[model samples]
Target: MNKFLAASVSPALYATKANARIFTLSSTEHNIEVGNWKIDSTQLGIIDSFFSIEQKILHGGKQEGSKIIILTSPNGLTITLSPTRGMSIMNVTGQDIRFGWDSPVKEVVNPTFINLESRNGAGWLEGFNEMMVRCGFEWAGHPGIENGEMRTLHGKAGNTPASKVEIEISEIAPYEIKIRGLIKESTFKKADLQTVAEICYIPDTYSFTIHDRLTNHSDYPRDYQIMYHSNFSKPLLEKDAQFVAPIKEISPFNDYAHKGLQDWATYLEPTKDFDEMVFNIVPFAKNDGSTLAALHNKDGSKGVTIEFNIQELPYLTLWKNTDTEKQGYVTGIEPGTNYAYATSIEREQGRIRQIESEQTVHFKIKYSALMNKEAVDKAKKAVADIQGAQKTTFVHTPIAKE
Candidate 1:
C-alpha cells in the first residue's frame, strides 16, 4: 500500500468487505504499475450504477506517454484527469456542456516535451489546455529574473508529473469517489515541496471538489506561492456571458486591461486577433469566509460556479481572452494567495506566502455545473447577497508595482 493511502485509510475500514475500494495505479516506491486498467460499479457489487474509472496512456505526438484517468459518474458527468501533468483536470462534460476550452494546442503535451525555459520562458503555454491547473509550489507568475534566478511562466507545478496515483471509492451511502495524486517538487539545497492533490465527487452529483495539501519538506522555512488556474469556454462562456462575483474591490491588470474595465464583469463575442485582458479582484465573502464566482451564458440557462474559502485564497484574477475559436477563446477564474505578476513584484508587494519546515497548507475548491435557469439564478443571487449594499471599489489602473 502507498504510504499516503496507509495513513489516510483506516485499517478497520479496509478490513471490512463493505468499506471501500483502493487501487494503486502507479507508485515508484512500491514498484507498482497497473497500466491500462479500469473498474466499474459492477465489479464493486454496485447495483444499477454507471460509476466507473479508467486509466490509460496516450500514444503518438506530444501527448505520447501521458497518463490519463477518465471517470464517469452516475449523474452523467465525465471527467478526464492527467496525472502525468501534475494531476491537472483536462476536461469535464456534464449534460452535453463541456467545461473546458478549445485550445490550439490540443494534445496533452507531456512535460518531457515542454521546455519551460524555451521561448523566453513562455513554453508553459504549449500544455495550457487543462480546465484546472496549479501554478507554483515555489514561484508562479510572468517569466522574469527574480533575484538572479530565471522564473518561467506560472512556475513548474503543472508540468511536474505525479510520483504516485491512486483511486478510492467509499462503500457507504453517497459513495464518494476520490482520485489522489502525490507530486513532489524538490531540489538539492534549495526547495523541497510536496503536494497531495485529490479530486472528489459523490456518485450521483453534478459537482466535484478539489482538495490539495502542500507541504514544505525542507529543513528550513521557505517562501512559496500557489494559484488555481480554472479556465472555461463556451457554451458556458459566450458573447454577453456575465462573470458574477461578490466583488468588494477590483482593478485592471494593466493599461490594456483598463480599456475593458467598464465591461470587466461581462464577456464579448469571439473576435479575431483579440488582446487578452486581466483583472485583479478582492471578493466579498460569507460569514464562514466562503465565496463563489460564476459564469453564465447569454440566456442564463446554463452556467458553472466555483466555490472556495476566501480566507485561504484572498485574491482572484479574471482573465478574459475572447479571441476567435481558432485562436483558443477562453476565460480564467483564478484564485490564489497573490495576483499573477512577476514573483519579484509580488514579493515587493508582500503577497508571497511562506511555510515553516514540515508544515502544510490546505486548499479546497468546489466546482458545480448549473444545468437550469433556477440553478443559475440561485448562484447569482448568492453572489448578490454577499455583495449586499456594499459598493465595489474599482481602480482605474493596476494595483501592483512593476
Candidate 2:
C-alpha cells in the first residue's frame, strides 16, 4: 500500500467467557521519515510529526486536531496544522514573522452527513477519539476513558456509550497518513446534535466507506473540519496562560462566553495571554506585518500561536476548560465552519448561497515551521485571495430558534 497506519495490529475488546469485561484492546503505530522530520502514527489513534522549523517545536496532527506538533528551523520559525481538518498554526514563538492576511472560509456540503472516516476512527489521530487530545503536539489526552461515562472530545465511535473501535493501517505518506476502523453508531440523551436511544444504537456500519487525510497545502479545501483540540501541559493555562487568533474579533454567538461585540477591539494582535474559547472571522494580518489575534504567556510574556487560514475557514473557536469539575485540562481551537453542516452567517443570511446536499467540497490543508509572526501574516493573506467571500451572515439575525 502507498501508506498505512504503522505497527497495525488489532485485538478484541469484548470481555468473553475468559475475559468477562466490556472493552478489549488493540494497537498500531508508524514511523515515517519525511525529509528532516520523523512522524509516528499509532493504533491508539495518535499521530506525531516533528521537524526543525527553527527553535520552536513545529509539529502537526495532534490527536484531536488540538495543539499541533512543532516543526522549527534555525531562524526560530516553524509550521504546523491538521491540514486534513483545517491547517492552523498551533504554536509559534521567536523573531517577528509574516504569514499574511486571513484567508476567506470555504464550504460546500455533502449528501451524507455521516461519511464514515474509518472504523477504528483512525485511532487517536481520529478527532472523535474516546478522549480528544492533540494529534502531533507535546501532549496526548486521556487515552482509554474511565467508566465509559467520560465525556470525550469529539466522542468517536469506540469512545461512545457502548461502542468500541479498532483501527487498520492502510497507507503512509510523506505529508500524511491513512487508516480505518469499525465504528458502531451510538446515542446519548444529553448529547447535542447527536442521536440517542435507550439500550440500542445503529448497527449499519460499513468499513468499505472509510478514509482520513492530513496535509499542508496552501490552497487546501474548506468543506471538512480542520480543527485542533489540545490540552496544553497543566502549567500552560494558569489564569495567565494566553491564547490568540490572527483575526479581528470573534463573532458573538450563543455557544461561547463573550467579552465584547463582533466588532469589538478586544482582539489585539500579539495578545499577551488567552483563556477562553475565541472565534475569529476578520482578516488580521497585513503585508506590512500587522495582526489582530495572538496569545502570549502570562505577565504578557511569550508563548505559542494558534492561527488558521481564513480563506479555507474564516471561522475559528478557542475553547478552554476553566472549571476542572466541568471539564478537563484542554483547550479546543477548532478552525472550521460553526456547528455541524454549517458555514458562516452569510449562507444563512442569503448573502452568498446555501450549499445543496451531496455537494463535495474539495480543497487542500497545509502546515509549515515558521516562528516569525510576520511570516504567518503574509501567508494568511496569500490564502485569502483564492478563498474570497463565498457567503456571508452567520444566522441572519432574529431567526426564531427551532
Candidate 3:
C-alpha cells in the first residue's frame, strides 16, 4: 500500500486524481451529489485490488429512488447498506454463508411511502426487511399513545434517510475502510438529536463494527432510547438452533412468551401461523464490562456472534418468529439501553435513559461470522467463561405491567 496523508477532494477533482482517498457521495450542507458511482483499489493507487465500493439506486415499486451502497472486502465479505433507509445493513454474505433473513417485505421501500401513523402507528413495518436496522434515537418499542402523543413503532431512526454519506480509506498498509453517514431526528421546539453512524471494515477479516455517536443538540435535557435489531435466518438458524449467552436474569415480555420459558434459548422448526416469542435478558459481563452472545446451528458447525459493552447496552431481547418460510421465519438478537416496552411503560419502569443538553453518547458493537465448527466452539467458550460460577435467574411471569 502507498503511504500518503489522508485528504478529501471534490467529486470532479477526485474523478481525475488516481490517488484520492476520500469521496463524498451526498452532502446536503455542501449541496454535492455524485449519485451511482464505483471506486476500487486501482482508483486509489493501492497495490491490492480485492476491495471495492459501489453505490446504486433502486428503481421499482416502493423501492424507486432508494439508494444502496455495496461493499466488497478482501476476505470474501460483502455487505449492502441502504443509505436511503437510515444507512441500515440490507444483507451480509461471507463466502457461501449469509447473515440476513428473507422477509415478506421484498422491496426496500423508501421512507416516502411509509405512513408511520397509519394502522394505529404500526406503519413502520412496511419497510422492515433489513438484516440489521436501528430502532430509536428518541423512543423505541410498541406503538401506543404516550403522554398524549401517538408513539410509532421503533421510532423513526430506521426510516430517516442520511443527510450526508461519505467513504474513506486509510492510505497505509492494512488499509481500513469507513463508510460514514449523518442522520438527524429533530423537531422545531421539542427534540433535537444527531447521529453519526459509521461502519468500519478491515481487510482479511470476516467481521465488521458499527461505531455510532449520538448527540443531543437541543438546549434542554432529552429522553432517548436505542436498540440494534440484528435479525437472522436459515443456514445459521434452523429447527435445532440455539441462542447462547451469559445471562444474569431473564424474563418473559408477556403472557405469550411465558408459555415458552422452558425453551427460551432454543428454536423450533418453521410451522404455520407460529406465534412470536420474546425474552428480556440481563447479560453477565466480564470484568471490563464486555459481553457476547452467539447463535449456533444444530451441530455447531456454523454460527454468528455479537460482541458489545454491557455498560453501553445493558439489556438484551431475543425475538423468535419461526413462522413459515414464506411468512418470514426469523430471529432477532437485540441489545439496547432499555427493553422493548411501550415508551410510557418503560418510563414508569425507569428504563428510559436521559442525556443532558449538548451531551453525546457513544456505542459500538462487533458482528462476526463463524464458518466452521472450531470457530463456533471458540465463541461458545467465550460466553461460557463469562458465565463461570454465575447462576441465571428466570422469572416465570411477565415483568412489565402493561
Candidate 4:
C-alpha cells in the first residue's frame, strides 16, 4: 500500500458536539488515530470560523455569587450575559470598541444583598450599570405603590434572578453558530414573565442581533411595562460625541432636558451638578421595520448603531447623566413600550400595556458598530431618510413627581 494510505486510520470521520468534523491520521499499518483535524461547515455560509460559550461564577466585590455567561465569536466579539441580573446583557465588545459601560461594582449581587430601599429610594441604582437591562412588569422608575403594593425604582426585573436559565447553540443556515438564551422570570401569585434572547452573528460581518420574546404567564391579565435601558460609556461617548436618531417628536422630562434640547444631539465634557435629563422621543421608522439611533465621537471613526423594532417599542428615551467626573458620564439610549414614567404615572396616562393570560409580546434590538466612514455614512443616511420623511414636533410636559 502507499505510505500515506497505509497511515490512514479509518475511512470514517468523527463529529464533535459542535458539529466539528474530525479526520484521523496514523503512524503505521493497524494505524491508530494519531492526528485529528477539525473541520466546521464553514462553506455552508457560516460567518464565523470559531464560536465558543463559557459560563463562570463571578467573584470579588459586589459580584460574589453571581453567574456570567460569555459568548465569543471568531472576530473578537464578546457578549456577556448575567443570569443573576435577569439575564441582562452586561457587555458587548470587539476590536477595542466598548459599547457598554463598566460599573464600579464587580459582582452581580442579588438585590436582597443591597440596601436599595434606603437613601430615599436611590438604592436601586446600586446595580444600574449594565449593557442592556430590562425594567418592567410592575414599575419602571421611581418608588411607587398601586393598591398598597410598593415597587422601587426601575422595578425588580433587573435584580430578580431567573428561575429557569438555558443556553443553546445551533449550526444552521443563515448563521454559523447562533447562541440563544432563555431566561424565565416568574413569581408565585405575582408576576410571570419570560425573556428569550437569540444572539445571531452573520458570517464575515461585525454586527449581531438580540431578538427577544417576552411572554406573560399569569392566569389573569396584568399590566406590563418594559424598557430596554442600553447604556454606553467612554470611547464611544466623548466630549464631541454626536447622538443621531430619527426623532419625530422630542420633549423634556424636566427643565434639565429642556435646557439641553437645543443641543440635544451634542455631548459635553463631564460637568458638576449635571442633573440627569431625560428626553422622550417619538421616532419615525423606515420601511425596514427598524429605527436607527447612534452615538459616535466627533471624528466619527468609531461608534455604534442600534436598530430597534419600532412597531413593538414605539417610545425612545435618551438619558444624559454627565453628573460628575466619576460614577456618572454615561448616556442611555432606551426604547420601550411605554415612556420612562413611574407605574402610577404610566397607568394614569393609560400608557401601560395589558397582556392577556398566556399571551406573548415580541421585541427586537440590533446593535452594529460603525468603525469606518462607510458604516457611519450608512447610519447618517438612515437617519436622514427618517428625518426627511417626517416633521419633528416638540412636547413640553411638567416632570412627574416621584
Error of model 2, residue 199, in angstroms: 37
Compose the digit string of candidate 4's lDDT tens values, residues 168-241. 33455444444444455567987787665456665445687777776777888877778889898878887878
Worst 10 residues of 3 by lDDT: 1-10
**Candidate 1 or 2, higher lDDT?**
1
lDDT by residue for model 3 (1-402), tens = 211112234546232133325677887776767888998876778876468999998899999999999998857689999989999999999886788999999998999999999989999999999999999988898888987999999999999999888887776767778887888999998889988888998866889999998999999999999999999998888998999999999999999999999999889999897899999999999999999999988999988999999888999999999999999899999999988888998899898999899899999999999989999999999999999999999998898866
Error of 4 at 147 (Å): 2.0
How far is 238's C-alpha from truth in model 1 (Å)?
A: 1.0
Model 1 segments beyond 4 Å from truth?
A: 1-18
Runs in model 3 deviating more than 4 A are: 1-9, 13-20
lDDT of 1 by residue, 1-402 (tens): 734645323322222234877777887766666779888887878785669999999999999999999999847689999999999999999876889899999898999999998888889999999999999879898888977888999988899988888888887767788899998989999999999999998876889999999999999999888889999998988899999999999999889899999989899899997899999999999999999999999999999999999888999999999999999899999989989899889988899989999999999999999999999999999999999999999999788655
- The window of 10 residues in a row where model 4 has the poorest summed lDDT is 20-29
Q: Choose 1 or 4, whichever is better by TM-score.
A: 1
Tens-digit lDDT track of model 2 for 85-156: 222223323344322111111111111222322443223232331112222211112222233433222333
